[model samples]
Every structure is written in structure tokens, then in C-alpha cells.
Target: MAVNPPKIKVLLSANERLQKLKEAFHGKYKESPLFYACAPGRVNLIGEHIDYCGYAVLPMAIEQNILAAVSVNSSQTIQLANTDPKYKDFTVSVNEITIDRENPQWHYYFLCGVKGVQEQLGLSSMTGISCVVDGTIPASSGLSSSSALVCCAGLVTMEANQKTISKVLLAETCAKCERYIGTEGGGMDQSISFLAEEGTAKLIEFNPLRATDVKLPEGAVFVIANSCVEMNKAASSHFNIRVVECRIATKVLAKARGLEWSSLQKLGDLQTALGLSLEKMLDLVEEVLHPEPYSREEICKILGITTEQLSKNILSANTHHNLICRPCVS
Candidate 1:
């Protein structure tokens, strides 16, 4: 007999505020006949800062996710509420694409997703809706809690319209929406959340949509440690700076080799265009961008970087430390 997939219960909590909000909303919106959808947060196991470059990423959807209750309105305005104490009531009109830094704070991220879907579908106006969001993931540990919110909002909106949506299209729309929020993160998080199967991890390659299943090691427990650090790139410009730097590096290398950088679709393509091995390409990236220290010195020289600058640059990148990538071992 074929076994049914095990049921997973998602817990909603923002340090205890979510429970109260859930109860309050359940009472207030109970008679409204709202529709609900969920999208989970993700943990990237490998390939950090490499997804935009067309490298493979290993990511898994966690049990924690954002549960959204949505009800359509007659007007073309979107209203949002978060179960957390930090977030307050916010409203937006579909015709306007403005970011509000102050009030109705939680809606900003979800609105980006809506904007992305709208732009992709060429819709002049979106169905006005009110959404109540409840999240279970940690705030800023790099587990992609923000992406989850965007995707869940998009899913809720699409379902409310009774539209048939594909998982791939939803993932792409969510990824595009994230760009509106001013973060140039890869599409790995949204893609993984939509595509990942329970009890398995996925290796995702962005261009052309290549995904492979990666079996989790037996008896292994995946633990996400909260660092109590809330770093959002929207407020600080550091994340944008890194994105610009990467673009610059790609352009420079492409010019040096007499090729158009835009034509280079994958990280592998960039490596081939530059005529550099994986180790050499990584070393070159480290030498110029200097995001982190070289785990090995011999690898640095092979890519044409002096040892003196390597250590200093790597140490500098370590100060903002939150989540470190741990390699998957056999």
C-alpha cells in the first residue's frame, strides 16, 4: 500500500504575540469567509552569494511558515495586519507602488510580492484584500523568513481570484517581488519553498530551472541557531553595495575577456568564459571582492591574489557574521 505523507503542524509565534493575534483575527474575520494559504521559510545548506551567479544551491523548506488569511475587498486597496506586536495596520492602493518605512510595517515585504505578481501578469489593478500574517521562523538568521511572507501573500491573492497558478510561476513572481524591496538575493528561497518535498533537500540552479533532489543524511538533525540579530538590507545599504560590486566584477572580467557580461547566464558559463577552473574562479572572486578569508592559501595564489591582502579582507568580512555555511558531507 502507498503510504500517505505525514502531516506537519506549523506553530505561529513572534515571541508569544502570534497566539493572541490568531485568536483576535479568528473572531473578527470568522464571518468574512476568507481564504487561507501558507508558504514556508527556507534554510540554504550551501552556495551562499552564488545563486545570482548561476551556481547550484542546496536548500530545504522548514516546518515553520507564514499562514495568511485573506479576504477580497471591492476597492483596489490592500490592507494588511501582522499578529506580532511590532507590526500595525497598513494599507496600500494597487495603483501606487510606494514603500512605507514607518506604519503598517509588515505589509512592505508582502506588498513587494504583490507588485511582482502584478507586474508579471500585466494587471492594471489587483483585487483589494485584507491579510493577516502569522510567522513561525526566526527574524534575521538568514533563514529567508521574508521570502516566505511574500510567497504566501502571492498565493493567497491568486487563490482568491480563483486563478490556476503554477508553482514555478509563483516562485518566479515572488523572486521578482523581492527585488522591489531592494534586496538582490537569489531566487533559491522562494523556489525551494515551492518545490521542496518533505524529508528531502533540493539542489536548485536558477537559469532554466534545474532542480535535483539531495537526500538528507540519516540520523542528522538540522538545527537553526538564532543569533538575536535583526539586520535588514532595506534600512542599511550594505547589501546593495555587495550586489553592485558583484555586477561590477562580472562586467570587468567580461570586458577583460572581450565578451558581453550579460550573455553569461550561469556561474559555470562565467568560469568558462574566463578560462578559470573552479578553484581559480573562486580565488579570483575572493581576491577582488574579498567577502571572506581564503580557507586555503594555495588556492588564493592559483587565482593571482597576494597572500597579504587575503587575510585582512577575509577578517573584515567576518565582522557582520550571522549565519555561516556548513558544507554537506558524505
Candidate 2:
């Protein structure tokens, strides 16, 4: 199996969206675009919130995706524009790519992808790019719109700069780089976005990134329904706090089990250490953690660490140290 995204030579005039995006790029920059890149969003098929624990997650790429028409330029700034007017245009110097985690804007997500590729390729300097982005994925709808945007941007930058990267490497880099926008998540979204193939889902496992294709049962029908609630990851500290709580909880459970708790970050890590089942893990949780929410003081006491260490190692950029939450979601 090829580990790289397939390169398709496009007949632009034939594909409607490509043609439209090309025209839009020409209209905006007064020049024809050089190339286009696309990356799909994903849907978790079975489970989530456990991939970070070194557990495998089942997810599949969706039809909706983020697509961009891009061209290299002598100008030293990267320019970004969206098809939707609600998302404002943005530009940044090629050498000065900063992601504003405080604002959590759409452009910052794209810049996260670009910055990720920049770091991966070790390019201290790169030519500027002008890109027109068009996305069909609904934002904040559990469709991984944000991760897809980042992956699309990463692919676009790599192609425009004439760099080569494997799909797995791209997925891993894109996963870590999404932290620029303050989304503290595992690589499930980015993995499935880049690693998934048509007509099959993938079991994405991290900490050495591997993807295994899984064919669905014959005639199994699944419907994806959005709840109309926007669960924006980067904008919400609660999300990261929940992640931190889980991390801390893993430590507590590990210490109680007479295992090294300090280095472990996910419950999956703890489970793997002792080789326990999900039911056994739950039993351990019931025995170790009380019904009440855990205070930061209590967590520190158990871990034998100071608040500074917790913030430095466990907490995410947007999450606060005053975090007092359950170690596991009830």
C-alpha cells in the first residue's frame, strides 16, 4: 500500500469546483493558480476521547473537505482568503507565522498547518503563497473541520514549496501542529483525514502512528446527525481541562496500582502497563477515585509534584491550573 497521498494531474476545466476555485483565484490575484490541494474531514465511527491514551480509534474520512487553490509568489507574505465572506482574509510574513490561540480564528488553523510543514521541512525561509480556500465541512459539528483545514493547508504548502512528505508523516505532523490553535487532542482526526481510503474505515493508533483499514459489515447503515451544538475545541478551555483531568486521573490510578504514574499521560497507558480490560479499568477507577471532584491540591499530593510542574507538563496552553474536575467522564 502506498503511504503517500496519490498525486492526480488535474484537467482543471473538467472539474467544476476546481474550475470555479481557479477562476476565483484568478479574479482575486489577477493570475492563474499553479496547483490545488484538498484534504477531507473525518467522522469517528465507534469511539473517541480515548485515543490520546495510546488507544486505537475508529474513524473514516467524510465527503466534505477543505480544498485550496494555491500559487507561489515573490512576495514574502502568505495570503489566505476563504470562499465564505464571514471568514475574513488574512496575511502573514513567510518568515513570521504566528498562530493566535487567544482568538481561535479560521486563518490561524491554516497557519498552524503551514507552520507545521515549515518546521518539518526545516526551512528557515520559504517562498510566499497565495491561497484561496473553499471548505464544505460544517465547522464545530464533530466533523473535524478544523483538523481538515490544517491538513489541507499542510498539503498545499508542501506541494507549493515542491517538498515531499509521506501521508503518515503529514498526519503526525499535522496532529502536533494543531496545538498552535490550542486544541489539545490526539491524532485521530488528522490521521483519518490523511490515512483513510475510500469505502473503508481505519483503526488509527498513535505513539508510532499506524493505520489499519477495516471494512464495514455488509449493508450496515450509519447516519451522522449533528446536534446543532457547536463544540469548538480551540475556543474552549473546558475541553483541554477535561483532557488534563483525564491525564491526572490516569496518574492517580497508576500510582494506586503500584505502577509508575508520573510519566503516563493517558488511561490507555495505565491499562497497558497492567494489561487490564475495560471493565477492570472501570473497577479500578471506582476503587481509586471518589465521587467528588478532585482538587488541584489533592492531585498534587498524589503525584508528589508542584503546581508549576503540572502546568508545565500536564496542562494545555488554554487550560488553567485552577482545574478541579473529574478524572473520568461519568
Candidate 3:
């Protein structure tokens, strides 16, 4: 039997939070929003950083989300407002949309989603939108508030333009577009946000991303508690550094296995090429990689590649601060 996917509906009348958001939007814009789009924040239960290495991650949708009240019109500009007073209102001409990565303002993340959808659909001109964003996810909580906002915006844009796309397509597009704001994500957040079904967690895998329902133990309750300490993964280079380290590890391991190392860019790709189980992959990491860091010169010599090829083909935009690749560890 074909299973039914979870239904996501706009039930403002039944949801107090959504109702307040709608009222607030109507008060600001003087008209009721035509429709609403929402994307929930996700909690990664396991396989956190490994997702970028093209591994499967276990994540579940939380109650907190980013909700947008939207209306399509012929205003020729996009207007944005937030329910929270701290975030000031922003507006931009549809013809001249721009996102600034350095500032990382609240609205710029919203634009990342808008611009992503616009480019994906290849719309010469977009329907102008007046949107009010209301978010329950705490910012910088490691719970994917920014990604939820981006996903929500992508949904809003698609709806405003009267376009229809599959959840997988929307998830993939939103994942790629979020990098415009300097985040090197692995699609875990967007995938879980769109693919999550009520009453079950999901195992989200990438490289032709798909989600499978995971049954939880009976009587188990998952609770999310904020540490109150915030880390913006995009604002810092630590996340990218880890990604580059993994990429380097993949190439090195491929070379050790007599595979064409240059073509391999992810740990998961290497794992697939070797046809090894996860346990075997972990064993291989220990057998081939050293605890000490590898310099670029040593890596080049080991891989039989020149320094120029290493820089041109392997290094990421932010990984050039040093020539050392960190030790590989699970």
C-alpha cells in the first residue's frame, strides 16, 4: 500500500500562535494574508557533523518553527516584517534583490530563500509579496532556526507564484541556496523540515536525499533544552574547517586504497567506492589515517599530486588559513 505523507495545513483558527501571527500581519498590512507557509526547526539526535560527509543523520522535527504570513500582489517590491519588534522591517525592489553575508541580518536569511526559489523557477519577474515572519525557534540555538526561515521563505515564494514542487526538490534547492549566506550545510535541516511525519523520527540521507521513518521506543519522550549559549555556524570558520578536514581525509583514504583520490570529495563517496560497512569504514579510518596533522606538502607527496592541483581542486574557500589537515576521527 502506498503510504500517505503528513499533511501540512494552514489552521490559523485552531492554532493560537498562528492566529496571533495572522492578526498581527493583518494589523500591519491592513489586509488578511492570502496564505501561510511554515517550516519547523529540527534536532539532530545523532550523526551530527557527519551529514556533510554525505552520511545519514537522525533528526526529528520540533514544535518550534518559522511561520510566514504571505500575500501575492503587483506592488513591484517585496516587503518584509517580523513579529518580534527587535527585527526591523525591510523592503527591496524585486528587480534589485540582494543578500549581504557579512551582516547576517534577520531579513537577509529570508531573502536567501526568496532568491533561491526565484532562481530555481527562473522567473523573469516575481510577484511582489508582503510577508510577516513569525518564528518560535530561538536564534543561534543549534536548532536550525535560520534554515527553517529559509525553507519557509522558499515555500512562501512558491505559493505566491502559484508554483508547485515536490518536497524533495524544495529541500534540495533550499539547502544549496543557504550557502549564499556563508553556511556550508549538508541538507539535514531542510530535509527533516519538509520530510518529517508526525509521531516518528526520520533517518535522512543525502546524495539523492531521502527520508525513512524511524519508530521510536514506546513511552519515550524527547525534550529539547537550550544551552542558552549560541553559536552561529556560518559566522565562524570552524564548521567549514571541519568540512575541509573531512574532504582531505577522503582524498587521503582514497589514495591509500589505490582509488583515484582526486575525484573523491566526500567521506561517504569513499565509503561507497570501497563497498564497506560503517564499522569497516571506521576501522579503515584508524588503519590509514594518523593522529598527527598532515601538511599540504606531505599530503601532495602521499597523493602524488602537485601543490597547485591540491589548491585548485581540493581546498575550500575558507580552508586556506593553514596548510595542515586535522586528524580524522569519528
Q: Write the per-residue lDDT of candidate 2 for residues 7-34, one digit (tens) a residue.
A: 8898887889888898889988999888
Clashes of each: 1, 0, 0
Top TM-score hit: 2
On the 0 to 100 scale, the lDDT of residue 7 in model 1 is: 26
In order, the Cα lDDT scores of the candidates are 0.66, 0.86, 0.86
Q: Can you tell me which runs of candidate 3 are displaced by over 4 Å?
A: 1-13, 300-312, 322-327
How do the predictions measure up, each by TM-score?
0.75, 0.94, 0.91
lDDT for model 1, please: 0.66
**Residue-wise C-alpha lDDT for candidate 1, range 8-36, written one tens digit per residue:** 44465643544555565666556343556
Task: For model 1, state the Cα shift of residue 36 in Å.
Answer: 1.1
lDDT of 3 at 260: 90
TM-score of 3: 0.91
Task: Determine which window of 10 residues in candidate 2 has minimal summed lDDT.
Answer: 321-330
